[model samples]
Target: MKVSTIEPAQPLDHLAPAGRIGVVALATDFNIEQDLRRMLPGDTQIFTSRVRNYNPLTIENLRSMAPGISAAADTILPGTQLDAIIYGCTSGTVAIGSERIAELIHQSCPGVPVTNPVTAAVAAFRQLGARRISILTPYTEQVNCEVAELFQRHGFEVLNIAGFGFEDDTAMTFISPVDIVNAAKNVCDAQADLLFVSCTALRASVVLDEIEAQLGKPVVSSNQALTWHSLQLLGYPAPVSGYGSLLQQLPV
Candidate 1:
């Protein structure tokens, strides 16, 4: 037997040389990661960890996932630095509270900026000077009410809110983008400044521009807003177009 050994290649630059973003997604979610990957810059990297989620997609079920947030966050590149971490849930953030979620994530990834869909959506709305907004969701009326109230508390007048009455997180991902556009148009108020489509499990990113073109108003979705806000925290200033108006606004 003969053995040959070659010298190892020189250490290469970090794989995520541009930026590293971590996501703590719901175990049942099938859309957020995919949407984020498609939206972010090619040089940037995405790392994800999933937290166990309860079924039926109720507030209680959503809140059940809260305890494991820190553990899920720690699993995403432990002992390494991340430009930002995203808690990829919309209704879950409303159920558990965005501030509390950020605190839990900080327990593991201390000093790292943490954001969730709800918070990011609010920021996107404010940045676009949208004081009156309408909403569309895949959740039942109960969850829809909470989402509307959360936005109202943030000082934005809720022009209208509508939903598809879905309860399964996984099923929500299968919602057709065309249906989302139609529902958004139906729910959006003519007088409102913007429309927000809530739900991380819904595939809203790919059709945002088309919706905007048809509605003649800006549209913000859970996955799109979260990606935009994460890029903002990472200091990525590129004006990303084709997704929607929010991404092209050039975060400061």
Candidate 2:
């Protein structure tokens, strides 16, 4: 079996993608790429690496997974130069702290923009002018409390939060968009300016607009927020639409 080599004869200028993004995901996750890639334009390319994780996501498990993320970030396609690297987990980011996660990512992909759901969610809420938000997650209540606390510490008011009481990432991936839509409705807070569905594994991207239409509020899911944040850091000019209003109305 033979693999093709890079065509040296191809145009040296702009021959590759306009931007490259590296996403470090959980070992059990299965949907980050399917959702993020469709939101971006064809000019970009995606690279992903999965860190170790397990089911029954206790606080101890979440905290223990933090140390291996930087090593996983190092596995991205070498020589391509990532524009941004995102640690793609909601609950894990809460446990590790976004600042610490950024520090870890920059250690490997220095000078590149670093972000995660926690960081991206904060930025997305700011861009949407949403100070008060309702969050829906597929995590156990134990994990949800920390996630709520994380949002509060970031200065957003968590008007309400609802979780599916799930701990397994693989099971979270199997959660249907309809179930997510229903959960969004159940957790809808009339006082909230926006709704946030938290979980890269939840496949909420496909149903974001529908949930928005039903709730009459913009919805920001884990993958959508991360995709928009990545594009913003990359300084991509084109708007990433159809995912939701968050991507369409970014600040520059």
- Model 1, span 1-252: residue lDDT tens: 999998869976678776899999999998888899999988788999999998898999999899999999999988888989999999999999998999999999999999999889989998999999999999999999999999999999998899999999999999999899889878999999999999989999999999999999999999999888988888886878889999998756
The candidate that wins on lDDT is 1
Model 2 deviation from native, Cα RMSD in Å: 2.9
lDDT of each structure? 0.92, 0.87
Q: Provide the clashing-pair count of each candidate structure.
A: 0, 0
What lDDT is reached at residue 210 by model 2?
89
Please provide, for model 2 over 147-248, each residue's C-alpha lDDT reduced to its tens digit, 9 standing for 90 to 100: 898899889899988899987878999988899999899898999999999989989988888898999999999999998888898887777667888888
Residue 243 in candidate 1, Cα distance off native in Å: 0.6
TM-score of each: 0.96, 0.93
How does candidate 2 score on lDDT?
A: 0.87
Segments in model 2 whose C-alpha atoms lie over 4 Å from true places: 1-9, 12-16
